[model samples]
Target: MSLNGPRGSAWAMTERTARDVDRAKHHFSVGPSAMRWDGETLVIDIAEVSSPLPYKVRGTIRVRPEMIGSTAFSLDPEGRHRWHPVAPRAHVEVSMTDPGLRWSGAGYFDSNFGDEALEDGFNDWHWSRAHLRNDVAVLYEGKRRDGTPFDLALRLDRMGNWHDIEQPAPVRLPRSAWMIERLTRADRGFIPRVAKTWVDAPFYARSKLSTRLFGENVEAVHESLSLNRFRSTIVQGMLPFRMPRAIWR
Candidate 1:
């Protein structure tokens, strides 16, 4: 899914998959999305989407590693789940050909892998990424299923320095239309406000917001996920409407 509310545009598409999925190493292709590491960079390609909204959307974004290191941390105490920001602050070049979608600028890339489904390991979580002048800061805070809470604060600088920073205070933002509470960590006196509601659903939401962090006022990508709500029958029933998928050849 992608959104540009400032330009009055948004899109979402999903492709169904079989029960058994290929577990290839560092490479996979399914439906409209595919990725493979080419030694120097991670290449991602997306084909034209035709669901949720009919539009020809496609692009290839390469995430090249920089001198600054990445972040790899475990989410659970048992090490069942882990997250990695391979290229926290990478130069993104976009060549997407679409009617109302074309952009090329700085972007972020990350991945998550776990031993079990998220619903079985987590209840809710708030994630935010702030791109600064010479560094990129990210925050991860959430509650584990076993009632354990974890908060991580990390910053990667351009000179290959990775350090742990103090956790900024939680800046509360207004709830979404779905009544999902939104909050993010920011520096002192750094007010954060949602600039756009890219995607808001019963159990998930993604937004772009502004905040002061790393001594700069930066726009951050924020997301909130509620595994408890996602496991509900009502949300599952409504999922087809937003993520309807057909067999892909």
Candidate 2:
């Protein structure tokens, strides 16, 4: 989960085992983090935290789908790797009691799952989502472990229709403070600039950018991930500090 605004930006992530996961239709709870569907509202309760956050975070973020288009994109011909964006344009209203955080804005949700590990199938990937008027556009580009490249551009409309737009030209943004390269696709006339860096790690980076897409200036949530670096022993050694798991009897 992430909180981004004028003041600052903060992000939290947790990794849990299958044993801790409770799953059902429109209902998911893993340890202290849970999300449930209440009619048209999606409630998220996040208590699992690692460092710097003084209080546990719990919030009800309403998700109203403006577009219903969705598909599971197979990253590998063997169907071992796939991605799905269930909600492309979701109207989100966020409210947190502790520490008093409240905001209402647009949001996006997607799921990526695969039988094989990420490094086993991907070298790296760059993903970004831009909210357009009455629609949402998502761009995905990456290279497979075999050095083959993949790209997709999808736009979902309020009428539940999907359009495959022409892939925009690639634009290289400035490197992160952590020295990781960042790139995103945009119109040839537009330049994407990272406005804020929420998390800049050895192998992963998440940032917010202001870019022009589909003829509109939009603020987008962008992420760059390097599975090759993540597989390194040095990066693996740093995981525990950000995502601390506990043992239970």
Candidate 3:
């Protein structure tokens, strides 16, 4: 989930990336499927997969009744997860309801956060979320590439657990399928990508480092992630040779 507008409001833009596409159709996408109480706090499960990347990512975010203490999240698929107070509030900037999770507002660390800070945050941000429903309203507003205000919202759908498994295509793999693609939309447009998370991602480590580290030790935890550069790629505007991989899985 991503932050959209001011606090109490949110906007979410779910996308398909090159990683998910296949002969069936490039398809990597993310969405909230189910949310329920694991007692007092809310537990949300999320899955993601990228073709170019070897790992398929999936995990859950747990929220406590207090909305602060015991509120944590973990990504088991990528051999990564952070449970401590990553954000300043010692919790995430989230509020959930019936339809989906809205990343409308961030943490108190960002209460005073503006554009530059927000931009940096996005680049470095892993994820953020807010809960919402029909009774509850959420509005996400931001600047588009043209610098125009970009906004979206999740009013009321039917929050919690999607109708079925949040898979890209109907096809299945050993654990799950993973794919990636590079496309040109037009003469002058951004390339399209497809990735599937929650559906499948590979985990190579035998030891669950994050779970053990977070559940036990700490250096200095984080509440919300400060964006730096989420992802970067080098393309050939002009080049004689191309980089190639020697093997394929």
Candidate 4:
């Protein structure tokens, strides 16, 4: 679990064995935290201690989907990886007891699954999602390990209809604080600017971009992931500090 905000930021990824995990049709639990779907909404209960700081991070997040998506797209030619936009549009409410904060806003939910490690299939990837006047736009592109490239431009309407649109021209953004490359897509002649950076790490970066997409101006949530960086020995050695392992209960 991770929370990045003005009040403070907390990240906790406790490694738990299979014995400490439980799951059902609509509920899943690992260690002290759990997520459950209650017919209309998805509720997440988080109870964790931040790594390297030991700060309490207890909160409840509710995600109410405005429209549910039903299609999953393949990310690789061999069908080894897939991406699904479960909730293309949603309303999210955040209530944190540890920090005594509450807020609500537009949100999105998605899932990704693969048969092999991400590094074995890709070099890096850039993705962004934005809300248009009556639809949502998602852009995805990446370079494969074998030097192949793939891209997808999709738009979803309020009624959960999906449409494939022409991909806009690529726009380069400033590198992250860690020197990670950042990129996005925008209409011709328009440049995309980084409005805010939420998570900036050696292997990944998440930020907000102000750009024009498909004739609409929007503030999009953007992310870049470098599998090569994540596979480095230095980053692997530093993972324990950010993601501590917990003893089996």
Candidate 5:
């Protein structure tokens, strides 16, 4: 779990064994946090202590899907990886006690499934999502381990319909503070700018982008992942400091 805001920042990634995990038709849990789907909304309960800081992070996030997605897109040619935008358009309600914050706004929920390790599948990837007037535009592009490239552009409407669209030209954004390469897509002749960077690590970067998508000016949440850097020994050695492991008794 991670929270970044003006109040403060907190991060907790506790690794646990299989004995600490629970799953059912509509619920999944690990350690002290869990996510359950009610009839209309997905509720997430978080109880965690930040790593390296030990600050409490307790919150409830409710995501109400305006429309549920029905399809999953393959990220690799051999069907080794797949991406599903479960709730491309949604309303989010956040209430946090440890930070004493409350807010609501447009939100999105998605999941990725893979048959093998991520580094074995691809080198890196860039993804972004923008909420248009009555639709959501998502762009995904990446390079495979075999030196092949794949990309997807889709527009999901408020009525649970998906339409394939032409991908926009790639735009190079300023590198992150960690010097990680960042990229996003925007309409022709329009340049995208990074409004805020949320997470900047050795192997990953997440930012808020001001860009034009589908001919509309919008602010998009963008992320870039470098599997090459992630599989390096230096980054591997640094993981223990950020993600503490514990056996749930």
Candidate 6:
């Protein structure tokens, strides 16, 4: 399933496997999130998942070495249903040591999390108003040197009392940042000596939104989404929270 969607109104469990992180060691590795609405204040929950059991192949147990989680968001009545998922309510925690890495943040997701979740096909974009809506997210758009668009979605829910903030998300560094050095194009089979990555989610009017970046290993693409040009960037920003430095190496 894709990690992004636009909730006009809107909307996770796995077991012990090899691909799964060690429950005793790095079990808190989760995210690539999503967003939706619960009632008013927008409830978003992200999990640090770890299951090194391997899930894609048919070798009894196979899972990809990627992080997992989801985002929960509502819609902005002022924006007239311009669903958009932004920062979490607060900054989640991500850390990296010499042997372990963990990411503790919030987003939107249901079940089965891994790297395969960001592939070309085999994804489900969803939303919620009365019931869960299976949506077709417009992804694969950004300018990360190559063409690695980060597949994500968003939604603005009824602000209720705290209607001042459009997408109330708490931007946090990925746990990966704790262990890995400066991100380089080589991180994405491209360049080298990345310098560093910078982020700032400039939220303009509950509807207009965009993310900019400078460095390497990142990709951007602007694709089609219900007659809208949804642009995005893909970077290594999900480790500083749930992963330890040990696991990062």
Per-residue C-alpha lDDT of model 5 across residues 37-70, encoded as one tens digit per residue? 9989999999988776778889999999998999
lDDT of each: 0.77, 0.80, 0.26, 0.91, 0.90, 0.23
Candidate 2 lDDT, 1-249, residue by residue in tens? 666666544456666777889999989998778899877767777664534443455555667765655588888788999998878877777776543678877777778999999999999999999988878889999899999998889888876577889988899989877677788988887888888888788988999999989888999989999898899999887876666544421
Residue pair clashes in candidate 2: none
lDDT of 4 by residue, 89-193 (tens): 999999999867889999999999989989999999999999898989999999999899989899999987789999999888999999999989999999888
Candidate 5, residue 157: the lDDT equals 89
Instruction: Tell me how candidate 2 scores on lDDT.
Output: 0.80
The true-versus-predicted C-alpha distance at residue 148 of model 3, in Å, is 21
lDDT of 1 by residue, 171-230 (tens): 888888998878798878878889888888899888989788867888999998888899
| Steric clash count of candidate 6 | 101
Clashing pairs in 1: none
Runs in model 6 lying further than 4 Å from the true structure? 1-87, 95-249
Instruction: lDDT for model 3, please.
Output: 0.26
Candidate with the larger lDDT of 3 and 5? 5
The TM-score values for the models, in the order shown, are 0.85, 0.89, 0.23, 0.96, 0.96, 0.20
Per residue, candidate 3 scores C-alpha lDDT tens digits across 1-249 of 322232332223234344533322322233433445444444555553322322333445554432222222221222133232222221333434412344422222212322232442232221122232211112222222223332222222222111211111111112223222111111122221222222121211011011111122211111122122212222221111221122221
Maximum-lDDT candidate: 4
**Model 6, span 89-190: residue lDDT tens:** 223433323113345543222222332212222211211111012211112111221232222333223231112212212122222232221111111223
Models sorted by lDDT, best on top: 4, 5, 2, 1, 3, 6
